[model samples]
Target: MSLTREDVAGIARYARIALSDDELTEMTAYLNDAVALLEPIREYDLEGVEPTFHPIGSLVNVMAADDAAADERALPLGIALENAPSRVGRSFRVPSILGDEGGAR
Candidate 1:
C-alpha cells in the first residue's frame, strides 16, 4: 500500500514529531517502499510450516557460569566510597528532599 503525504503527516502527528514538507515527502516514499518490500512476505504460503522463536535452530547459552567460588577478591568499602563528594559515617549524604523541619512538603 502506497502511503500519501497526508498519511505520513498523520503518522508524524500521532508520534508527536514535527516534519517539514520535504521530510513528509521523503517519509511517505520510504514507508511505501517498506510496505512494497513486505508485501511478498505477507502474501507467502506458510500453511504447514511451524512457527519458530529463533530463525536458525536452538540458541546456546553464551553467558559465563554464575559460580561464586570462581573468584574470591572482595571489593573494599574505602575504595568504593573514594569518589563520593559528600559522605557521612560510611554512607552517602545527599540533599534533603523534605523541608527545613525534615517533614514532607
Candidate 2:
C-alpha cells in the first residue's frame, strides 16, 4: 500500500499534529517506507497455525508463602498518627475532593 502526501496530511490532522509542508512530505516518505517493509510479511504461509494471546501460553500465578514478618514491623495507630496535621476520631482528615456538602457526597 502506498501513501500520498494528502494521506499523510489527513493522518496528521486526525492525530491533532501540526506539521509544516516539509515535515508532512518527510513523514509521508517515512510511513510509506514502513508500510512497504511490512508488505513482505504477507508472503508467509500459515495454513494451520493456532492463534495465541501469550508467548508462554497458559501461565498461572506463581505465588509464594506470605511470610512478610507479619505485624512485627507495624506501627501502632496512635503512634502512627501522632504528628498528623488534622484528625477526625481515628482517621486523618483532609479537604474533600468531590467538592460536595459534608453530609451526603
Candidate 3:
C-alpha cells in the first residue's frame, strides 16, 4: 500500500489532472500515510464480533415499541395544495416530461 511519487503522477495522469511536482510529492506522502493508518486494522482479529452499522451503541433502536395503531391525522386537500406553485383544476400542473412531442416514446 506504499505509494511513490511516480505512482501519484500516474494516478493524476489517469484522472486527467495536471499536478505540479510539489503537488505530486505531497499527494504521494498523504496517500502513503493514509494506507499506513489502515494497515493495522487489516491485521486485527474479529472472530466472533458482529458487524456494526453504527459506532454508537445507544443510537441503535434494538427494542422500538410498536405504535403502528396510533390515531393518525390527515391534511386536508385544500391545505396540501395551498403552497403549490402551479395547479390545474384539482391537480398540480407540472412541465411535460415528454418534451415538445407531448407523449412517451
Number of the top-ranking candidate, with TM-score as the measure: 2
lDDT of each: 0.82, 0.84, 0.81
Prediction-by-prediction clash tally? 0, 0, 0
| Rank ordering of all candidates by TM-score, starting from the highest | 2, 1, 3
The 10-residue segment of model 1 with minimum total lDDT is: 68-77
In the predicted model 1, the residue pairs found to clash are: none
TM-score: which is higher, 2 or 3?
2
Q: In lDDT terms, how accurate is model 1?
A: 0.82
The sequence of per-residue lDDT tens digits that candidate 1 reaches over residues 4-101 is 99998999999999999999989999999888988777887999998887787877758756785665554567876789998877887777676587
Task: Give candidate 2 regions above 4 Å deviation.
Answer: 60-105
| Candidate 2: 10-residue stretch with minimal lDDT | 96-105
lDDT of model number 3: 0.81
Question: What CA RMSD would candidate 1 show?
Answer: 8.9
